[model samples]
Target chain A: MEESPTIYEQIRTSGYSRRDFLKFCAWVTAFMGIEASGIGNVVRAMETKHRLPVVWFHFQECTCCSESFLRSSHPIVAEIILDKLSLAYTETLQAAAGYQAEEVLYNTMKKYKGEYLMLVEGSVPTDNDGVYCCIAGKTSLDIVKEAAEGAKAIISWGSCASNGCIQAANPNPTGATPIHKIIKNKPIINVPGCPPIGEVMAGVIVYLLTFDRIPELDGMGRPKAFYSRRIHDTCYRRPNYDAGLFVESFDDESARKGYCLYKMGCKGPVTYNACAVTKWNNGVSYPIKSGHPCIGCSEENFWDNGPFYQHLASFPGFGIETTADDIGLAVGAVTVAGIAAHAVRANIKKRKLINADIEESKKEGGE
Target chain B: MEDQKIKRVYVWEIPVRIYHWLNALVVVTLAVTGYLIGNPLAIQSSAEAYLGYWFGTVRFIHFVAAFIFFFNFLFRIYWGFAGNKYADWKNFIPYTKKYIRECYDVLKLDILHIKVKPFISVGHNALAGLTYFLTFLAFLFQSITGFGMYSAMSDSFFPKLFAWVVPFLGGDFAVRQWHHLMMWFFIIFAVVHVYIVFYHDYVERRGVLSSMAGGWKFIEKDKPT
Candidate 1:
């Protein structure tokens, strides 16, 4: 391995000041929700640790994961994160071609065996000799296995690499499979989303660089810090839900006012993610904030769950089965009873009026 | 059977009655509208295909009624502690020895059809009181969990307060399953409650249903508490 220049030297060479470096650490500390005291640790790690070696692989995906990753707003996220990270081999970003790229991957695998990070960006195909996808006449499964064999840990970039995405959706002809399903020995972190927020991707990488290990993950193998709360939990229009103010139509006044989208086929109630809180574009707006419903891209198999436009029946209401329809059925039955009561009361009133008329006629006849 | 009118005092106030009826109305509305949204029962009218006005109107009514029912829950909880002897917490909870014995007597009278006279009180009967008490507990749980689920979207204060439930129920998927199952329980409870109320009022000639509307029921002169 080459004796690389220290991060400070690289930062100076890269045109970033010492003050800028400290500010970046502070920003990352806050974003990770760590205390100010922890800022020193992150700064120390970044300054001391050698640049992390990375090998990124792509298969059976739309490349949206890489698209989102490049959009990270943090200055170092683009500079120190992607640039100084010693990204030796990546099919999407690497410029080297043919034998040169393959040579770099093989050298990195041999040089930093069981030490470098392996980031897989897409799902692997398994059927028919894995012939559905190939690079340099080799199947994607073989390529992933060969690269993953020398990696310390792996990060599945998105839903495609984590849970097979739409490729594994209905009849999965190519036998598409997530990275975790194929590799069990390595510690795999699944950052699931159609395309996860750019900052979250940066945060995960930062956490790994700072902590030198994978962050705590939920049962689904997603980092707990980001996926802890549902998008619904952090949504701004929640008051409208409690108030029963819902947007009935896309063009309705309620929709314009940004009322709750629960009635309008929003899966936000059942979907869990940090979209509403962390948001996109520097925390400016999320799907719900942008007048779109959450399709629950973070959760597993969101595509197979159902149509995105149709509302779920009973969302976890009050942690109970208080679905909008269940509540409606209960009300409909009561309304019918109310109507019956109204009919009975009206009949009795009519009968009394007729009796009074008969009595008046009898009195007039007698007179 | 003719029963003589007695001095049976009104235990439920106008607010209490309003709360009760309003809750009933809203709960029913929520169940029906909620069902249609989930399963989407087959449409009967051709206009429903192009317009969907009826479904939309039902949903609007359902949400409005839910707001009222939620308030009703709040009011009832308050009344359970603040109201008169009958509406008070002591009446609902059968802790006293005499009330426990009365429960047995009431059950015996019901089973044997002994033609025994009715007792007068502002509160519910022992069995009825127990069921209502359970319903209140269910309502409280539902409110907290519902709010937990609700705040999940808006990041409201309620979800923050009850955020611990997310883990206890095993993530969003389990929470969703629990929420779905509990709705059916409420629907079943509502169905059985209506059936028994109507059966007593029409078949058994007990006039129980009328008491909800008129605030009183006639009892035989021979009855005593």
Candidate 2:
């Protein structure tokens, strides 16, 4: 950590002006939802602060989070933080290999003890003695537990690391578990998505480095600045949802007209992410912008929620696939039928009892 | 009939009666709107999106009714403590051995048909009381899930209180599933509840069904020895 240059030194060496660095600081400050006064503090901290060491661990993941991070939307993110963070050891980006790579990872673990930030990219598989996912003969579960012990704090880079994304979906064969489930002591910031938006990924890191503390988190341990509002709240097609103008199918005219994808199971209503606002691929277009429904990748157990192509008419729960209305109509019909049967029997039985009482009264009166 | 004397008993108090009817209306409204929300009507119009706020209006009605339902439930809870002896809190819970026995007795008569007559209680029978208590628990569940989902849409502190439920229950989808399923619970409860009330009115010759409306139940007096 001490050997690396501060972010300010990196900018100075790159021949960028003080104004450029100030602008960068202000941009991150705004993303953090900090007041205008906080920009100065961010600048002061960045100029004096030593480059924080980061260890990015990849396990049962697709490396999309790394892709999103490297291709971050922010103009300065790819250039500044990428170079400034002093990535001590990352499986995907590092050039070293074999024992040399393993040696760097171990040395960083020792030298940066209680100081290095650990960014976990995926879940740790724990089934069958963690045989499902192994790296260099060590199970993900064992490696993560060992690596987590000396970390300053942990950042779950995507839904894979946050809530056991797809691998930990229903009937999870690998017994894949998220980092938080395995490491309880460290403060974890879960930036969840199939792959979180590039800007959001960059924002989390910038917030951590600038503030030297985790940002305000929501109940889900996600940064409140990005995850507090559902995608529906900020969606541009919101008027269409509110108007009930929806695309019934992908080939429908409404699809060309840009109607809301909600009817086609757009999970934008339930999904919390910066995708709607930030957009993907340098704010060019997102899946929703291209007429595809949001899959709610950021949410927990999203894969098991239901089919992505269908709306909320049905879901799998109660040990069977059924909907509320289907069960309601069936139970209602049966209950009415049963009641009709009960009424006839009850009336007939009551008549007999009443007549018997009348006869007994007559006998008593005659006596 | 000629040898019997009848007495009129005031069982349901005015507040309790009002709460009952209001709750029924709100529950019906909520169920209908809630179902539609889960499965939108798919009304396709060539008109611009601004021309129709049909779905928005439906949601507005639901939110308003939800607020009314929530407050009405709170009022009933207060009435349970403040109202007359028949509408007292003690009746809702099976607090004693006798209460449980009466529930079993009502079950035997109404359900098993082992007895030929209706179980008589000026207020709700023990079985109905206990069942209604369970629905109250369902009411709590629905409110939590309802407001929990609403928290995402609104920034109000009241709704925000239930925000933790989303993550706790896995997510919005799981919460919505439970909320939707519970709607059927109320509907089924209403079906059986109405039937039993009418069945009692017929069998017992008491104003059981009308008692909820007019607050009077005709009780047969002691027979001449």
Candidate 3:
């Protein structure tokens, strides 16, 4: 079997000039937040290294990750990245079906053992012996275990795979669990978003390919280069949040004027993601920019964190309509009422004791 | 009947009195600002976003109060080690059999409303000491979670030290929830603490409130030690 050409040769054959290929390398390097000095190194790595074989697996997911990846703004992302990388098996993108797809998966595993990358989308269902999500007559759990054993590193593509998005929300019927929970031994990198930005997905892949190692990850196994700061920090309307100018309602004047959506339960402050910086659909706009508050889809248990349109409040149903002042005032009133009642009881008890003392004194006098 | 004389016993040292008032101020500031941070007032300002900065000011006040609260609590801990017996760290632990007995006696007298003679201690009773110890732990938790959340925004090394606490406690949202809940704990503690102090002042006639102010607690000279 003739060895497949390097990504550079593939790019050259595809009629992209040497300049276009170096520009692609520099663009990916910039996305990875590598210093300008490392651009040549990135170029060298891309020119020399073979495209790593990626086995993309889908479980209980919305297929939004693949959709996002397909929509990458870069011209070569779909042409070069999707086509050039040896994507041996993917349910959504693969041309082969059934036995042929299974053959590719097994062949890739056997040939590139301890070398291929595993990209898991969505979460694996554990209930009823993983009956909820099955592929090719095998439970996703079984497939994940089999594939993860041979992969170099695993990338949990979305919140479903990273922190068990909506599938693993409250009363998770399927017992859907994130990849990291089941595959404990593997070096897992979590790129968590509802459907993480395409540029970020490419950035993660490029960083891995260039450095031959995973990017510096934060405590949650997310790449620090992208997920280190919160969306709130980089948001354009942050000054409004700092200034206490909030959108009171979805259709209010503040919303029209692009004030902060914090009062409307924007989870930007608590959610860590690169959405505000990278944006979505080719740096056009994110949820916050499009007159909607962040649902915090990237954070853990976001679906259970309460309603999307209401800020974090003690009471579930009384989030947007009721202010903390209302609760504080009510508590204050109750505290005062209790104090008053206690005071009245204490006063009556004191008076009774005083009366008893006088009666005892009078009885002594009579004696 | 013989006349009763009052002996003024210096219980709270200057450092303890200072710590008490400072802690009270810091706690109040922290609770108010912390509540505001969680549930910011919808201030409709006609001024530009940069000019208004009202929420930022609230956050700044909260952070400042948090630092003071943390350091004041630390100072109190140090005073517990270095100050007199009344301010001793040993009093807070309640490990000794006598301390445990005093705790039970105080609990009976206060909560159970039993007519048991109050366990007379020059400083905080065992129950109060234990409560204060728990409050200290709560203070530590709030600091960890608060700083942990702040670490994301701040570039300073002090706040960064607690960055791991957010991930350890699950995430930023959970950390905020726990931090907010702890604020209620402080508020409740303040209410109960104030009531108990006044009640003790009335019953024991030890000038509980004034002692906190002046560092002198008056005791009946003829009373048993």
Candidate 4:
């Protein structure tokens, strides 16, 4: 295999000072929740290890994952991260296009077979031979299967790739399927979110490059360092939730006071991500911090979970679409009414039976 | 002569009566607190957020009641095997042909109101026993969903065992929705159960309500049923 420039050498050639390179390492290491001692190791690894070749692919997605990755909280993301990786091919960022782009993809696969990382954005559509999404006349199913055949590990970049995002919501017409579902043999990491926090995307890539192995994963195959805890668990507004102080609506007085957004259909309690702690846009604020409920963008089938402003989800079955409370109340009321009617009829029947028994006893005594 | 002849039968033992009452209490506790945890009341106090821990207290009550309910259910399972014939396992499970017939007979008499003769059951009637068996399954459902959500907040091994249920059901939202709906099941069950007990009490004069409290039910000595 051809040797690639180390991250430090590439960064220096790209006009980044050595101090800037080390600073990026420390920032990413801290974001990964690694101890202070781990920062030095990260720097040493990046300075010596050759650039890891990556073949990033896009399928049925909104390109927001790429947007989030390139515009990570740090300024060096586009410069170092994109430039540092010996990126063989990426539809979004690669300078090549058309047939030339296709050639790069094949050459990288052939040259770095079993060595390069396969980073996927969005989901693959398999219905009708994967015609829903086609890149250069080849269906996503064909491309993904071909690309994933020899990769060491697959990093699914967002809810689109990890859990099929909006495309795989209820009544999915395209049969959009996530990466892990299709590529069963390879090690997969699911970084699920509408567009997972920018820093988190960077952290996942950094963790893999530094250690040359996948990070610890949760039951959902997400990196545990960032996806283990629910936003509610570490939320600054948790005290308000515990106190039963909640925003009833968008313009309510409770909302003005910055009480918990749970009553307004905030799904922080159910969604697992680093948004509450890591914040977004370089620690500026997250959805809850900005007066909007979480909407559970990070969880699977978040779009189908329910309305964005309702606390309860719309139960899926039974042709009638309604909240649990609506159905529960209706069923409960009907049952009570049935009981009332049954009690009235039962009482009448009991009285009639009792009078008949009394008459029979009197006749027996007279006889 | 038939109306004058009567027999007092020992139906429920002390253990069965205690289990019944305890289960009733636990169900009420769990349903109320579980509902509140899902749709908490907006009690905005003027005091600081830390000063009011009402929601936390509601959740704590739910957890405590849930544990009690789970253990109470387990105890009832044990009693189904060990208790007297009236409380035996055979009655709860409608396996035999006779038990299935009893269900039909009771349904005709109580619900259809077409059967003139009253169906007599020394213990729970087959239909009611069958309903209770279904309720037990609902009980198990609530426990599974309850523990699954609890696993996220707790590090204990007991709750951890149910962690698999979270992803299995598609995560926290689905589990909470299901658990909340089951609370309504218990509510409806309680309403119907109480009405049936009263209706039978008036018709039979067999002390159906008192039987639960005193372990005795009055039966007719002449009738074979």
Candidate 5:
């Protein structure tokens, strides 16, 4: 087959007008947090560069990442970006099956060796000879290592691929491990939501396509452009949080008024994601906007952190539903009971000593 | 009884007494407010969302107490260096052979409940001194983790100094867990500390409780200086 056309040619052939293309470029540039001056650079890159080949892999995940990516609200994002990308092989999206799919993946890896981008969407299990998750009779660990060796960079999509998600929660039976931990040599960028925002995913791809390099990453290797700030920092109900107003429960008046969900165990304060600033479903509303607390899905081991409905106080794995008050009250009761018991013992010991002293004095008086 | 002579030894200085009471107050404030901050009460208020700052007030009290606790701890450290021999930094550490011996003696008398003659000290008993040392270390841990969590929400330079601690310890969730756990440590320490002080006052007859308030401890004149 002839070499694939540049993104500009693909967009033009797809019936997108020049104005529409430039508008998309500007929109992506802004989404990438690039200044207005950088719009020309983004457009130029798109016009000149051929789409990069991506081998999307799945190990042990729910395919929510791909679902979220396909559901990108932007028309061009879903239509142009996903379609235009040289997605050589993806288990979920690829039409080929069995040997044909494996052949495509091998071909992409060989043809674009050290050039293709590897997008991993799930965690690789390391226990029991990696029998928990496998593809084509090859364990995920073997696949990830083999793919990562030749890829230019790896994009760990979603929490499963980033931090093991619920699969890596306490007592992880399969011993599921994230991609970054498995592949240490490659420059891995983690997009760590349960299902990262579709726009954010698109923005990361656009950034890589435009800049020809991975975006700036935070300490946890997430794109700083989107994951730099906590959800609470940009939450609309922050004023209510500062004023100590919170939703007491799901059906309460405060919930109707859309009060802050901090009291309802919102993990927004600790969770770093673009959900608050870039609301999901085409900026319609996010979890907090819908009067539900943030479950902190993007955070590492968030499932093991605590329950979704309770605050963070009852942490340290006492129980799923136990709150801080329960622990405190129990400890307080124990302390009181222990102290009372000690006090009673002390009183008995003192009385014994006094009686012994009285008996000794009486004997001395008789003598 | 009339012939018995008592010598009033000034062990805790005014600074030590002040630090003790202030530290106690700050610990109580931090425990209650910290618990409330961790697990806030569901206050059903008829007031507007903007008008109710109750939780914020609880957080404010916690932060303020944390600050006071931190600085008071710092002042105590300073006084430990500058204060008299009894309040010296050296007293807190069990470096010398004497301190170790005293520790054994006190353990035998108090915890072990042995009938051995108590070896009296002018200042803190070696065991008490060691316990205080451990509590001080716990205080430092709480300060670092507490300020680390606060750094995210605070704009202050001081709290920001501890900002690195959160990422260094993994994340805010872990830091909060540790900070909460340390609060319980303080509560347990307070209970044991107060009980031990009273127990020593009864058994040793050393005015251990009053000594913290008045800076003086009554020692038998015949006892070795």
Candidate 6:
């Protein structure tokens, strides 16, 4: 192994200082929800470890994932994640073009075979020999397969790469397919979202660096730590949900009260992601916090779930019992009806007894 | 015994009664607020016309009521074991064969419009008892899922305890939809309850409405068991 260089030395040589390096590490630790004690491990890894060789590929996508990553507020994210990491080849970010870019990709594949990480953005189109999406006269499907053959691990960025997003929504023209659906042999981690929260992206990378392996994932291949809870679970407006307060319209009194947007077609209850707690724009606020209902963008096939603003009456939960919309309506209506019926039933019995007593009193008086 | 003598028998303990009424109140509030929120039928204007928050007030009241409802839930559970015999598990469950017979008789009479008068229990009748039992079960369901959703934040004890519901219910999306729909059941239940109470009071000429308030329901001597 090559001798490891200290991060401060690396950053200083790259024109940064010890304080700046430590601050960046602390920020990373906070973002990742790691303990203060874990800071040492993070620092050590960054200082001694050589940047992992990464090959980023773009397929049938709008390049939003790249845009979201670059928009990350943490300067170190750009400085270290982009600058320090050995990003060997990326079609969007790379300056070299034509044969030069192709040469760099080939050289990296040969030099770090079965060692480099493969990052895929967007979906792979498989229609007509994958003619819909191509790079340098080669189909995206062909390129992905060739590059994936020697990758150590694959990370599917955003819903496009993770679940095909809108490209695979309905009547898919390009036959857009998620990475795992096409290539299942290699270990894959899906970071799903509509341009997933920036911190989440950063956190995933940090976890990989610190643990030297992929984080535990749910059955869908999403990291369990970040994707386990629904956005409804962590929403700031959740109290309104439990209380049964809801916004009737975008301009109603309840909406002003910051009631749960659930009734207004907020998909938070069903969607899982870290947007509510971790938030966006640097932990400042999320869509729900800003009074917008969750579109459930983090979930797979969110594009086809339904219209964004129509409320769903009921759905099955964990099969504990169906809390159907009609059930609530039934209970509400039945409780009142049942109570009144019982009251009437009781009265009829009571009146019969009172009338009988009156007759007995009259008889005794006559006797 | 002296004529016109009155004796008081405890029908509901303090917490039990408190929980009962407050739960009723919140469920009603939730149904109303939930209805407005879900359909937004009450709103006639555009989203931007009213400061961008359409049903904000209803939702606020709904949440406040829900808080009260959950609080009542905690008390109800405690009272089930700690309450009087009339308010305990024995009263809440429909286990006896006699109770089953009463329910059958009542149903038959309703369908046939039979005129036979019968003796009635001071407590909730068989049918009423069963409905209450189911409502209790519904309350339990609501509370579990309610906290399950709440547990998402605070990472509180309840969400972890009830985490199993997530998978069993399919996913969070389904769980949430069920939660919203259940509100409608409560709404329909409330409407029917009111209609039946007033209808009986008018036709039977008995102080049935006062029984809950005064806790004494007098019966005529001719009534047969």
Clashing pairs in 2: none
lDDT, candidate 1, A1-367, per-residue tens = 4678766567778998889989888887777767799999888988887778888888999989888878767777777756888898888788998999999989999999999999988899999989999987899999988888889999999889988888987678999999998998999998988898888888888889899888998666888788877676678877565445667778976777777787676877676667887778777888888898888886666675555665653343333434545664676587667646644653454455447757866996698
What's candidate 6's DockQ score?
Answer: 0.20
What lDDT does each candidate get?
0.72, 0.86, 0.85, 0.88, 0.84, 0.72
Docking class of 2: medium
Give chain A TM for each model in order. Answer: 0.84, 0.91, 0.91, 0.94, 0.90, 0.83
Q: Mind giving the per-residue lDDT tens digits that candidate 6 earns over B42-109?
A: 33333333344435566567657766787787777677788776667676677889878777776655
B137 Cα displacement, candidate 4 (Å): 0.8
Which 10-residue span in candidate 1 chain A carries the lowest summed lDDT?
A313-322
The candidate scoring highest on DockQ is 4
How well does candidate 5 score on lDDT at residue B159?
A: 90
Estimate the lDDT of model 2.
0.86
Which residue pairs collide, candidate 5?
A: none
Kindly list the per-residue Cα lDDT of model 2 for residues B1-225, writing each as its tens digit. 454567788888889899999999999999889878878887888888888899999999999999999999999999989999888888889999989988898888777677733446777888988998999899999999999999987868999999999989988878887888888898899889889888887766678888889999888676321
TM-score of chain A as modeled in candidate 5: 0.90
For each prediction in turn, the share of the native Cα contacts (below 8 Å between chains A and B) that it retains comes to 0.07, 0.73, 0.63, 0.77, 0.36, 0.32
Native-to-model Cα distance after best TM-score fit, residue A108 in candidate 4, in Å: 0.8
- Answer with 2 or 3, whichever has the higher TM-score: 2
Clashing pairs in 3: none
DockQ-based CAPRI category assigned to the predicted complex of candidate 3: medium
Error of 6 at A348 (Å): 14
| Candidate 5: stretches off by over 4 Å | A1-4, A313-320, A344-367, B1-4, B94-101, B155-158, B167-170
Q: What is the TM-score (0 to 1) of candidate 4? A: 0.95
* Model 3 per-residue lDDT tens digits across residues B46-70: 7889888889999999889889888
Poorest lDDT segment (10 consecutive residues) of candidate 2 chain A = A312-321
Candidate 3 lDDT tens digits, A227-276: 99889999999999999999998888888899999989899999999989
Winner on TM-score (1 vs 6): 1
Query: TM-score of predicted model 2?
Result: 0.93
| Regions of candidate 1 where Cα sits further than 4 Å from its true position | A313-367, B1-178, B185-225
